[model samples]
Target: MTISTEQVQTAGRLWQEHRQAPFPDSLRRAEFGGTDVWVLDLYTAGCVLAWLDNDGILDAENGRILQSCIEDLARVIPEVNDPAGAQYCQQLHQLAVLISKNLASTK
Candidate 1:
């Protein structure tokens, strides 16, 4: 998939925003939306941003994988007890939505 300049710019901006804070360390287990889920820490969110920035491109395969990760994170956002972690996850979710939209545009 060919990534647009806008997508690259958006990814960069998101990466910068994600890096502004230290990743949260607490892990909590809870059920959300009637499903058991593990709340993701800030590290996971950082990894997502890093993955996108590292590649500078989101192909079909990798985009799917990353999107799934973001979706999973979104599902458990309510479960995250740490305010920072929830914010990070919310940022990650936004990044994921951007990637998904870009991928769809390419298709």
Candidate 2:
């Protein structure tokens, strides 16, 4: 499924607000889609969120990698369609948008 343009634009706005918040020094090694990766924290939440920004599999300019991040999060996050999972969805959406905007600026 494709992410709507609204999702990207809304996420872009949300990203601007939290762009400066530091990711804590605390981190751990984890696996994502069979690849070994370092993540911000042990919890799946942190790991999934970090995956959006760091995974090299995505091509930022084309937006496919950002799309992949969103798809991956949907699979990894439990009950993503449920009310409690809304926050995870929101974070994923924002990160995807941030990635998109950053890539666009470089072009």
Highest TM-score model number:
1
For each candidate in turn, the TM-score is 0.63, 0.36
Task: Evaluate model 2: give its lDDT.
Answer: 0.41
Q: Write the per-residue lDDT of candidate 2 for residues 1-107, one digit (tens) a residue.
A: 24445644555465545454433222123344553222311232332234334431233333554555556555444433344334534564556545544432211
User: In model 2, which regions exceed 4 Å deviation?
Assistant: 1-11, 24-27, 35-61, 79-90, 94-107
Q: Write the per-residue lDDT of candidate 1 for residues 1-107, one digit (tens) a residue.
A: 56667777877787677677565555344445653333333434544554465545444556566666676877778777778767766876777676566552321
What is the alpha-carbon lDDT of model 1 when measured against the actual structure?
A: 0.60
User: In candidate 1, which residue pairs get closer than 3 Å at backbone N, Cα or C atoms, i.e. clash?
Assistant: none
Candidate 1's displacement at residue 9, Å, is 1.2
**What lDDT score goes with residue 52 in model 2?**
38
